[model samples]
Target: MSLRVGVIGGGQLARMMVPAAVNLGIDLRVLAEAEGSPAQLAATAVGDYRDLATVLEFAKTVDVITFDHEHVPEEILRELVSAGHSVHPGPDALRFAQDKLAMRRRLSELGVPVPDWAEVRSEDELAAFLEDHDGHAVLKTARGGYDGKGVRLIRDVGESTDWFRILDEDGRGGSLLVEELVDFRRELAQLVARRPSGETRLWPVVETVQRHGVCSEVFAPAPGTTSRLVDLAASIAVTIAESLDVTGVLAVELFETTDDRLLVNELAMRPHNSGHWSIEGSVTSQFEQHLRAVLDLPLGDTATRAPWTVMVNVLGGPSAGDLTDAYPKALADQPNVKVHNYGKEPRPGRKIGHVTATGDELDEAAFEARSVAALLGSDISIAP
Candidate 1:
């Protein structure tokens, strides 16, 4: 019998994994949130991920259980382990990804460099944190924040009074996280894969560009990066993966500060947006590597397929019509570029798809990617 892997959550990440599973002869099963989710092609069960019976029932069908996202409740995951089900990047490591304050505290204990942070429960506590950070700080909800949501830049304590009030009303009564606003030159990401047996592999660090807090572009190997910087980034990712006992793919979002210091900004324990370029750029795509890692199979080559690869997201696709409307012109315009539609309907600022271009020159690759992104209804203007 072929090995079966059950994935929780039915987003684009799981959708992307289907092709990899087919190529490797692995049976992929998905417990999608809805009937027409992006991963519906592989979806075998449609139900609520938070409902214990639904999840446990799905778990019985696969040899190992993984996730498309990290929002699954901790208690449910523990129950799976207790019942002898295999879960990659298990609950202990997942908690850090789910809660920012917990992540900061644990990273601090590991001597991982992160932004100065404090957990504040009230307006006065928030005020104190702001006062020390030159009256400006980034406030974040410990959970449920992603792609520019649940985070705010505040110059005064009153700016977060509503958040504090909301927390007060919550029976959980959680404290918000406040961190020193980082002065960074640019954002970077390191992608690594580890198996249950403890062997790990890392890809070249890449540069990420964010627009309105959503990742819009990624430049593989991060143009102009020094060898020392690349080694340093690799070391940091490997350390975190081993220390946390993380399995499957781990994406480490980083800040390359102006003074040349590298600081840990965030962590993602599965296939992430920054590594999307790997689909056509790496010898082994992150999707494929994730499957191998989670199944305890030997990893594959991570070498880049070209000298440069640029990925640009298709944000809020087609101003007035379906994505298919623009495909004719987009494909003809940049025949060399690869377009991946996530089968999602367009909405303002939503990631409907992405485009990638690989070449021997960075300028040409970036130009092709940005050109296709605009033609596909992404809001970004191609740089002249």
Candidate 2:
């Protein structure tokens, strides 16, 4: 019998893993919150992830458990471990991904290159942080924030009073994470995977383009990356995975500073968007690698299959309905391009899927991916 892997949360991440699990002879089961969630096609149970009893019952059926998102409460994860379930990137390491304050504190302790940050629940505390830095800063909710939801930029701390009020109204000071706004030259992502038996590997550092806090595109081996920068990025990811005892995949999102340095921006201990190019670009895709890592299987090579690979997200547009209608046109236009639709309803600005392309030249790879992604979403022409 194949090892059964149970995934918590039913976003596109879990949906994408189905095929990879099937190929590896792993039985993938999903616990989704909704009947029509992206991973519903592979769902074995549908219930609230926050409910302890619901998750525990599902955990009993699977040999191992992993996450599609980091929103699972720490208590639920810890309870699973207490009950003897195998959870990759277990509660101890997952806490850093779940809470920005905890992440910042822990990375700081480890001397990890992270932007100077602090925890603040009130405007006065935020003002103090702003005063320490220039007059501007980025404020984020320490918990329940992603894809721009619960993030903000403020020159004056007073601008955040309403959030403070809401937090106070919630019966106590709510979680708030504040950080100095770095004058970053660009954003970079480094992906690494580790197993419980201590095997680890790193993927090439990649450049990430963000639109309104969401990832828009990814370029493998980040164009113009110096050997020094590449080494530094890889080392940081490796160190974090080892130090945190993180199992499965760990994505280190960093800021390439204007002053020529790296400051960690965030961490995601799972298959990440920046590594999406691996599906068609690398010797081993992250989904397959994640399964291997969690199962204590020998790790695969992280080498790129092509000289260059580009991935562009397909955003839902005003004209978007069902993307199936556009698939024929996109595929016919660029058969060399690889398109992955998340099987989600089209809502404006939503990330429904992505398109990837690989080639000998960076320009050609980027052009193919972008053009197909544009066709799949809005008709915005991307100039090479």
Candidate 2 ranges beyond 4 A from true positions: 317-320, 379-384
Model 1 misplaced regions, further than 4 Å? 381-384
Q: Model 2 misses residue 210 by how many Å? A: 0.1
Deviation (Å) of 330 in candidate 2: 1.2
Give per-model TM-scores: 0.98, 0.97
* Native-referenced Cα lDDT, model 2: 0.90
Clashing pairs in 2: none
Per-residue C-alpha lDDT of model 2 across residues 37-129, encoded as one tens digit per residue: 999888999999999999999999999999999988999998999999999989999999988999999999999999888888678888899
TM-score, model 1 to reference: 0.98
State how far residue 274 of model 1 sits from its true place (Å). 0.2
Shift in Å, residue 306, candidate 1: 0.3
